[model samples]
Target chain A: MDFNIFLETSISIAIAACISCMIKICTVTLNMKSKLDSDYFILKNKLILAKKENSILVNKVVLCNEINSKLLQSFFEVVKQLLSLQKFIFEKGQ
Target chain B: MKKKLLSFAFLFLTSFCFSQDHSKIIDSLKTVIFKKPSDSIKIKAYGDLCWYYRTESIDSAFKYGNLALKLSKETSNQVGEAQAYNDIGILHYNLADYKKALKYYDASLKIRSVLKDTMGIAALYSKIGLIHQNTFKLDSAIFYATKALKIYEEKNHTRYIAYIKSNIANIYRGLKQYQKALETHLEIADVNKSINDNLGLTRTYNNIANAYLFLKDTVQSEAYYLKSIDLALKYNYKKELAGLYNNYGGILHDMKKYLEAIDYNTKSLKLREELKDSYGITSTSLHLAGLYLDLGDFNKARNYLYEGLNLSKSFNINELKMDAYDKLASYYAFKRIPDSVLYYRQLFKSINDTIYNSRITKEIAEVQEKYNSAEREKEIQTQRAEIAEKELKLNRKNTQIIGLVTLALLLFLLGYLLYNQQKLRNKQLQKESELRQALVEIETHNKLQEQRLRISRDLHDNIGAQLTFIISSIENLQYGFKITNNKLKGKLTDISAFTKETINELRDTIWAMNKNEITLEDLQARISNFIDKANISASNSNFRFNMDEALSKELVFTSVRGMNIYRIIQEAVNNAIKYADASNIEIHIKKKYEAVVFTISDNGIGFDINEIEAGNGLSNMKKRANDMDATIIYKSQIRKGTKIILSV
Candidate 1:
């Protein structure tokens, strides 16, 4: 009878140990899932911020390109006027 | 009368020098300019000389072109200055100095546009496109080529139109747009033939052959190649002929006619050598190496490959050197030399890394150039507008919104996918852990049941039988007293003595069974006992097994883990006996480098390690070593038994 009790106790202990291990695994998995969700949210927020920044940069580049074109055009026009005057004088002299 | 005769002589000589040809005209003009030291005539003479030598000698052409530029600057002749810049740009382009060529081309374009020289601008655009094509910027090449084509078409310049068409075709070929390339080449070829332009026709034929080759139409490719070759030979263009031979060799090499390929490549190599063409030699050597490799002559292949690699390296030709490294790696792999294969693979990787970086640089340069050119065009148009009204505001606004929208969409998708993947992974891990726990529980329960059954059977078979025999003996003793016989009494006494001895043996068995739980100390004691037995057995030879004194008595040993360690030691000992056949053995166990290390060494007649097969026992040892995440090394030499070292 004592041996039977011993066997029953050992079986019960083994089952309890398995149940505890499974609970630990489930808890760990749940913790990991929460951490992953948090990380995802952080990354998503960062991506949105980066997108906003990129849009601003693109706007700035476009504005700069436009201003640069205008300046170069005015500069070229002045130079062209000077060149025409010189050509006119040279042709009139010839 | 003598003075008049001398004057006539001088006048005739001067007129002859001026009227002979452009080169003679340039020479006489140079002398005149040297005497007078005037800028206008000198610039004209330098410009003419630059045009004359443009195709023949790039250095001299550039030199004279620069001289013209300087003279034009002194005379304030913008037209002459622009022409000189264009000539210098062409010379640089011919020399493959694209960066410098682009600078000169841009300078000439600026001057030409200022002077309203539309033809000059168109020509400069063509030259820029040619530079882009040579640098493998196919899209930019096509853009400029098309711009030049439009201008030439508007001016009704048929010859210039044909040239632009050919340039566009070359760009298309570079882009692998075979159908477009072929159509353009055919149109250009017809125009050139109609105009009786043999030089242009030969180039067109070569372009056609390249397009057909890209289309994999070998017959058409060969036909056009032969036509180009014939024209090249007839015109005595050694450079073009060399290129033709190399192209033909590549085709034959692709066709698997190695001998013919080698023959053609050798011809090409000879021509290039005569021409002092280092780049051509690098390419031809690579083709020859391919031929040798295809013929299965690895030694010859390696010889050519290494030669090509050295030449390419010396010339700083990264592309050809990369090819050579790839071929060498393959050859070493085919030869089954693992070390050589690994070395050449590393070389191949380094070369590829360099090529990737260079490609990225090339891409960035191309984009920059396109952006700059577009900006220049915009600047030109904006000069005509009085008020700088912002036309790009709407475009910028639209682009910003589009960029933001796309980025938002991409980010959302990425986050969604990542979330889903994480959830899936967690589910899988949970399931795996659950399964593992179930297996462990089932195995432990089954083992316990088997142990109990075996114990029950042992008690029933041994002790039950012994007790039954004692009961029968007592029953017979009672009968013996009833009989009252001296002999029967003596027999009963013997039976009692035998029964007492059996009872004592049963008690001892029970005690041994109760002592079966092993402790750490008990494990160490058992190992020591085995070592002592081994020492006595190996008395003829010197043997030592030592454990570190620093080992703690509190060190726990699970039976299963302990059995594995014992088995590993046993296998090592058996291997030493069978393979090492050593006269001396030393075994040591200690902690080192954060690991427990077990070492066994012997000095005996060792066999060639390379000849030993990794049999089942060795495989098992390796697998167990892996299970423990341990490293095992067996080192031996001839006439030296072996040393097996394990770190866990």
Candidate 2:
């Protein structure tokens, strides 16, 4: 009879421990899941902002490339006019 | 005349032998009975005392038998209960209470039969046979005795077989089947010898002696009676001896040895009185009364007659009572008293007639009982059939109702299913529309992002080509002209260098933009490339990058985190070379628990953390660490090395 009680107590204690572990694991999983969910939203927002910044940088680079190309075109024209003037100076000097 | 008394108290002989051997067994049994706490032991002890006192004390015997029987029933010891019933039956048999004896024997037989105690059942059969024999039911006696003998024979129970045969012989002798009686007694004697049962032999010898004396074989009768008497005396079987003496007296009276017969009869009477056997005493009393009447001893005749008559009346020994009455009528007639003779004669006839009438009434009552029970059985069977028919009708109605309910349930279920299906379909259609709209939105976003990447790649290609073409044109102009103009060459070199720097910056931006995720290996390769360039600029300084093998090569980070860590490393390295003027700089990456640790150390003129000014390099590193959810700590002294530890 004493052995029976001990066996019953041991079995109940094991079951309680197992259930408590399950509860604890469920609680931990919920906590981690919520934390990860919030992190995902925050990261998602950051990704949108970075994508906008990337688009702005892309636009700026494209505009700068166009402006630089025009500037180069103007410099080439000035260089052509300078070369003609240099020829004129030589002809006058001669 | 044949001595019609059964005298078959073989069971009592065996029980009394044990009891007589230990005269104080009753007292000891009583003492032990009171001492023991267990009901079973007490029950057994009480049963023992009950049988022990069967011939010793009538009231004590019944008291113990009742105690044993009640305790056995209370304890539910069926074997003990059957034994107690048998013991009580024997007590009744000894008291000449045949009805009560048969009742107890029937009770014992029922229990023993249920228990399947073969020996006990057979013993009850034999005992019941004795009761039937004593009651002049010779056919029933023969039937029961044969049943007992068959069982004993099947079991190879020789001693019990002898006991049963002795009963059968007595039964046969009473029925006056003398030839059959003599044969059965001879078989009983042989069975007794084979089993070596002395008490059985004593009873068998007496039976044989009676059979011989009745057959007119006085020589054989006298010889067999002496044989029985010899064994009875030798074994100290006082019960068997009393019976033997009674039979021996009857034989001697048949031989006209009246004086010798009286002596044996008186001895038998004294022994029966000592044994407290009411039947035996009454039988001997009547026999002695006849012997005295024969001897013309009227005083003794009258005394013995009254003694036997009173005892037979009290014990309900009707046959013996009638014998007493008949002998009393003879006595009165011999005394020349016609009034007394007539009175006793009437008494004798009435008792005889009552015995006959009671037998007839009992048989009629039994037949009536059997017929009434048969009618009751038939009536019960009819009622059961009616109940079954009603149940069948009710079941049919119940089944129809159940079928209707099931049909209604099925119809309701079918309707509910259609309603639920319609609801589910509408909800599904709505969800599908929303999913399709979301897919279209996501596809549009993907297309825009892809366009942006394509445009960025095209811009980088254009700008990179332009910068390279301009650098090459300036180099060609300087070399082809062989220009010794130092100012113009210096200006051209500066323009080329600036354009090269822009190209490198563009490449770095594109590298960071294209990747969604970066690993430590990727960062390490980028950092090593920057360090190589720094080494070329500062050849006197030593640069080291160390990564522990313990750190997993698969360590990954989001693009933002990767860009932040790379920028932090670059800013730290540049600050060390330009400001700290470090001779040796080490970039070490290692694993710490679950986190990765990066240590950028410079063995240069270190500045104290508290005294150092808050610069863009240090603040940028702190901001990057905070962005990545990492902690940064700067350890430095004025003269010691400066270390920046970042844990992620």
Candidate 3:
């Protein structure tokens, strides 16, 4: 009877040890998975913000270019008008 | 002499009437048109009046030109129409509106081309070339000038030829080809002298001197310049004298004679001031600034540059303003004022970019305009040729129609033949489209039939054979049950058990097929249960199974992939059970980045890993892994149990 009890105790201990080892491994794997998910969310947020910033910068650059072109066109028009006026006055004097 | 008298009379009637009361002349011409209303007289009156008011009153010129165009069109008179368009173009040219000028010039050229008026066309070319030259289109200027020269030479119009040569020479001067410019000017001078054209002679000598100056031939340039100045004084040409002084100041400035440059520039400035010439004043101020800068008087230089900059800006002369900004930048840099230097540099760059971009825009527009005009000419030529062909064809058709009308009784017989020909053409087109659609439909039907046959073959060859074998085994088991021998009973029992197992496997296959839509959570739970059962059956080994809880519960696998994974795990466990005398086995299921991973390990007496060949079971495991696009690895040693890792 004592031997039977000893074998049962050994089996129970082995089962307990196996269960404990499995629980420990599962816990470690779960922890690693959660950490990877958290990292993925962080990188996704950074990429989204970067994309938004890049778009805004591109819009500003486009607006600046438009303003520059308009200003140049106005300057050219003014120059053409003045040159015409000068030529007209010079011809009248001649 | 009569032609000369008529030319003078026309010039007098136009110029003197404008000098008198312009409105009265317009009223008188309108009254005459209202009374007589003759198309030829109306066109002549409008043309004469347009030339009179072209410079001083552009609107009145446009009105008269339009009236002349209307009258000329009413009479279908090409000469009158060309004259009206040319007058309108001259008015626009005087207004410095080159775009409007080009439009009228094109219209005039079109009418003249229709009339085959070579002289009128050549005159229009010269006018257009002058406009292009004034707008700084040197290449176009050269092109039109050459065209006009060729036409004048052909007509033996020597005076007009001299004028074209002088225009060409001026273009060469503007382009900075000084040697070519001098040669042309010399030719003009010789021609003018031969004709005793005193005004032309004066202009030619001035142009030659300008060319020599550009070539840096100081002695000849100075001599010619003096002669030009003397002639202007003799002619009392105040405007010409001012220009001569300005050119002389520019030359003196280039020679580094600062005081002489200042003196000549002052004289030019005084004359320009008297004349109220803002452009000339601006030029003299710029020259004075350069002299001050050379004399090391920074304050005076700044004052003069500022003055020039204001005048140039107010006049809207960007080129002069750009020059002033360049000078200002240098002055500020020399003054050692960093901020002022930077500001002026920025101003310089802005003006420079504006000028360059504007010039490029203008050039591109001009090139496109030229291309369009050339295309239009080509189109007109094609149209003319087509019209000529059509006219010839129409004349032939008219004659044929007249002959057919004369023989009206023959017309009914040709109609049936024409109808039959058209019917044949329609049939040919219909047949072509019908054949095309039939070929496409046939190909699609053949492909569909091939797919159906492949599916039917797979069903009959695989599942049908397996069912037939099971049926035969079952019949044999039933027959053996009737035999009472102990050995036969054992054999029959083994056969019965084997058939039952095969039935169960077939049922499992059906269940797996039905569970195609199972979620990953359910699959994981089933796998865990399977591992638990395996652990219970496994002797002398403690089994452990682990999984990641953080894996998404909604994850799913396709039936084919799920079945592959299950088979691979089953094979691995069987190998462990057969070969590994392990005391412990661990099965791990976890998520690895984007993949699902399964690892099975046992601590046992391992075999020589490298020497072991893949047996049937191992190969089956590899095949199952391959079906799922999964990777499998087996690690073993002589004394260590094997480990199998699978990733999908």
Q: Which number leads on DockQ?
A: 2
Tell me the tens digit of each residue's lDDT in model 2 across B299-367: 999999999999998887888999999999999999999999999999988998898899898788867
- The digit string of per-residue lDDT tens for model 3 on B1-648 reads 644544454445555674466567766666555555446766888887786555336577789889888889889988998899899887767555678889989999999999889899999999999999988888889899899889999999988899889999899889888899999999988998899876677777888889999898987887877787788778755556777877877778788888887887888787776655666777788878878888888998899899999988887677778888888888887788888888988988998999899898877887899899999999999999999999987886675555545344333323343454445445544554454444444444444444443443354334435544644654665575575546545544444444444444444343445453446676677667666767776766777877789777788876556656766777777678767878888888889999988898888887776778878878888887886678998888777778888998
lDDT scores for all predictions?
Answer: 0.70, 0.79, 0.72
**Which segments of candidate 2 are over 4 A away from where they belong?**
A1-94, B1-20, B24-43, B66-82, B102-118, B137-155, B168-178, B212-222, B388-648
* Colliding pairs, model 2: none
Which rank order by lDDT, best down to worst?
2, 3, 1
Q: Write the per-residue lDDT of candidate 1 for residues B376-407, one digit (tens) a residue.
A: 87887776452333445455446555655655
Could you tell me the lDDT of residue B516 within candidate 3? 32
Residue-level lDDT of model 2, residues A1-94, one tens digit each, is: 6764464455556555555655665565566556655655565565566566554444344434434454455445444544554565467569
Weakest lDDT window of 10 consecutive positions for candidate 2 chain B: B1-10
What DockQ was computed for model 1? 0.00
> Taking the candidates in order, what DockQ does each have?
0.00, 0.04, 0.00
TM-score of each: 0.43, 0.50, 0.40
- For every candidate structure, what is the RMSD over all alpha carbons to the true structure, in angstroms? 53.4, 14.2, 49.4
As a whole number from 0 to 100, the lDDT of residue B168 in candidate 3 is 93
lDDT of 2: 0.79
